[model samples]
Target: DAAKEAIYARLKKSEAGAGAMHFPLDRDAQYFEQLTAERIRTRYVKGFPQRFWWKPDGRRNEALDCRVYAYAALHGLLSMGLNLNKRVEALPPVPASRQSRNDPRPVTAPMTASPRRRRMAISSNYI
Candidate 1:
């Protein structure tokens, strides 16, 4: 409950232009829909209240899940004593030569790793 509240608060603040977080200008309607697919619901179980985010059937919520995971990751980083603001400030500006032509941002090499193959068990019934 607390975590969900915190996430909503941050999102609200950002939407109100009072937060450092910003969304891309190219986000589509479907993206926004997925981002807000879930709603908070409370139910009583054994006289105890249980709160959870609920989504209707056939609704996709990958965006919301990604946001939650991102918030958790940021919380984890802060708990580890990493000053993200300071780290951002300490970074040097990108040189014009290093900047991409299409986007005014520095280009970084794509991360690549060999895919790991997993072993699967076969049942005699299937065979």
Candidate 2:
């Protein structure tokens, strides 16, 4: 029950833009035992959900339902004892030249794009 509340508090704060919402990527149950308000808030900010910013209206602006999937995936990773930070670090970085200067794509656009079109280019995978 306490764990749920902590996560909820972080969610509320993140929605209100009160602070950063990054959570630790570790799944060790013991890790959560050491969480303080400030620490959990930091973890939430760094978690997958933070990558998809909420709109000013406190709604997800992304069309991909990232909040749902990101959280789901986070928990899944946690259950498997996987380190999100490691997975992220292992992935290749995106080049600055890949981003378009004239027409910036919406944050949700990538997931909403047709799978076939998305595979057309490596940059489009996350564009």
Candidate 3:
């Protein structure tokens, strides 16, 4: 939620910068809220630059989401690549060899794939 708020601030500033690129206000508040939300998500989940639909010109723009850009510019370089399964991944593989006085063995388990039903659950809940 905090990041989302920050995204809102970024979007607001961006909207001002965009001038004519902002999403149309005619749709209603709910639509704006929805658009704001997606913008925030795109920042972290997909890297940077959120999407917006401008009503004045009825065009979609991929304006640079400065908030995300700043975040990624600072943090992305340091992070190891994220594994896709890690999002809901259970754990790492267990050790297959070696032993220790304390019965040394890897305890982490690999992630389980989401069942089809559960897989679809995300888009519905979050979107």
Candidate 4:
């Protein structure tokens, strides 16, 4: 009965959604234990749904995460336990090219050659 009341109170205080709390990754049950106790004592909540961020490139196998996941991985507190199917490509650095000259071009007559026939060299955006 008391637990039920506490749960209700915690839900009421969760106006900021599930982002309000985080559980550090660890095998030790103490992490879960203290999480529950703190929420119950202060907010009276426990166990919100997990959240994830889609990778910028939208790579299925390379589903990178930010915020909480980044924090956890950086601290060696968590590891991706699943077998992911993806490749990690090393992105090249973007060169600091000078801006195009602002000089205006004078109007000229079209050449006898076909204008549609032109060459194009595509480049990737490396940073």
Clashes of each: 0, 9, 1, 2
> How does residue 94 of candidate 2 score in lDDT?
53
- lDDT (Cα, 0-100) at 69 in candidate 1: 86
Q: Write the per-residue lDDT of candidate 3 for residues 75-108, one digit (tens) a residue.
A: 5644766554554355544355533435533455
The Cα error of candidate 2 at residue 102, in Å, is 10
Q: What is the TM-score of each candidate against the true structure?
A: 0.65, 0.30, 0.20, 0.15
Best by TM-score: 1
Rank candidates, TM-score, best first: 1, 2, 3, 4
Candidate 1 lDDT over residue span 1-127, tens digit each: 5655676667666344555356676789898788878889999999999988899999998887888888888889799888867766666776777676467454443323333321122233355
Off by over 4 Å in 2: 1-4, 14-73, 98-127
Candidate 3 Cα errors over 4 Å, as ranges: 14-31, 37-78, 81-127
Report lDDT per candidate.
0.71, 0.47, 0.47, 0.34
Residue 120 deviation, candidate 4, in Å?
A: 60
Whole-model lDDT, candidate 3? 0.47
TM-score of candidate 2 relative to the true fold: 0.30
Q: Which residue pairs collide in model 2, if any?
A: 21-44, 21-45, 22-42, 22-43, 22-44, 22-45, 22-46, 23-43, 23-44
Worst 10 residues of 4 by lDDT: 58-67
Using lDDT as the measure, name the better of candidate 2 and candidate 4. Answer: 2
Candidate 1's displacement at residue 99, Å, is 13
* lDDT of each residue in 1-127, candidate 4, tens digit only: 2333333355346455642433234436543332233222222236655333223242232111223344455345325442222211232332334233442333233333343442221122331
Which residue ranges in model 4 land beyond 4 Å of their true spot? 1-18, 38-127
